[model samples]
Target: MVLPGKGYRFHATGLTHDERGYPDMNVKTQDLLVRRLVDKIRLNADKIILVDERWMEDAKVVVISYGITSRVAVHAVELAREKGIQVGSLRLISLWPFPEKRISQLAGKVKSFLVPEINYGQICLEVERCAGGKCATISLPHMGGDVHTPEDILAKIMEAVK
Candidate 1:
């Protein structure tokens, strides 16, 4: 689900809804279903949660971004690298069932994580939780009229390294 910038508009025609029957809401049945779903997600997490890590070797700081924001982050990471910042780029291709294990591992290795998102700090919260106070998690939030400039992300990356 791509959350576009504010004032971004599109027209969808001939959209059809698949009407699945109402979920079984009996307490016992619901509990069982929920447990099964959680198990399924856990079992497939390695396959479902996609993350792209770049320049991570010996990185002191990592930039974590998703959706459209990840695109901007790539340029910012490249610029940071050109300036010789020991920063890595971690683009989250799948947000749900988040890559907490990777974040936790990196937290122990890196000084901080910079999460720049078009929204006001959703994924950053998860990053912070996963870091578990092992390292700093900086939220570079944008209010969503448009995507953040690479310079903005680069500035945060610079801050994170410090």
Candidate 2:
């Protein structure tokens, strides 16, 4: 069940549907929406929100990144590791619900979070919102024409770990 998303680097061709206004939410539509919400949460949440969490145990900082920007984040992570930084990275395979619980838990244990995104901190807003000042939080945001260099992200990781 691969969902359509903006993975522009991979050259995905799926359209992102845009709908607004729930004024027509009558009984049938409302029930269907409710059932879908429950089924996604109660039945298949773990399955839906794919995460790579191997580095959680010892990481001092966690990088939350996904989509096209995730590949760049990997380079940053490797560089940080080379410099002997206990930096971890989490690629958000699902964007919704924002991984609040995991972020909060990591905040309790780690020093901070680094979120690098192609846009001007759109997703970072959600991260800071969920972080709730638990630990240090920062975002490496760009205007979306070019990706962040590993050096750029490394600098932020270095700053955050400090």
Q: How much is the lDDT of residue 60 in candidate 2?
A: 90
Residue 114 CA displacement from its true place in model 2, Å: 0.7
lDDT of 2 by residue, 1-162 (tens): 344474533332223211232244467666766676577775665566677664666899999898888888988898888888899998898886457778777878887889999887888878787778887778888887778888889999988888
Model 1 lDDT tens row, 1-162:
335565545433232212222344466666666676689999889889999999999799999999999999999999999999999999999988899999999999999999999888898999999999999999999999889999999998887887
Q: Model 2, residue 46: displacement in angstroms?
A: 2.3
- Per-residue error for 21 in candidate 2, Å, reads 21
Q: Kindly report which residue stretches of model 1 are placed more than 4 angstroms away from their true locations once superposed.
A: 1-25
**Could you tell me every candidate's TM-score relative to the true structure?**
0.83, 0.74
Estimate the overall C-alpha local distance difference test score of candidate 1: 0.87
Task: List ranges where model 2 is wrong by over 4 Å.
Answer: 1-43
CA error at residue 160 for candidate 1, angstroms: 1.7
Q: Which pairs of residues have clashing backbones in candidate 2?
A: none
**The best candidate in terms of lDDT:** 1
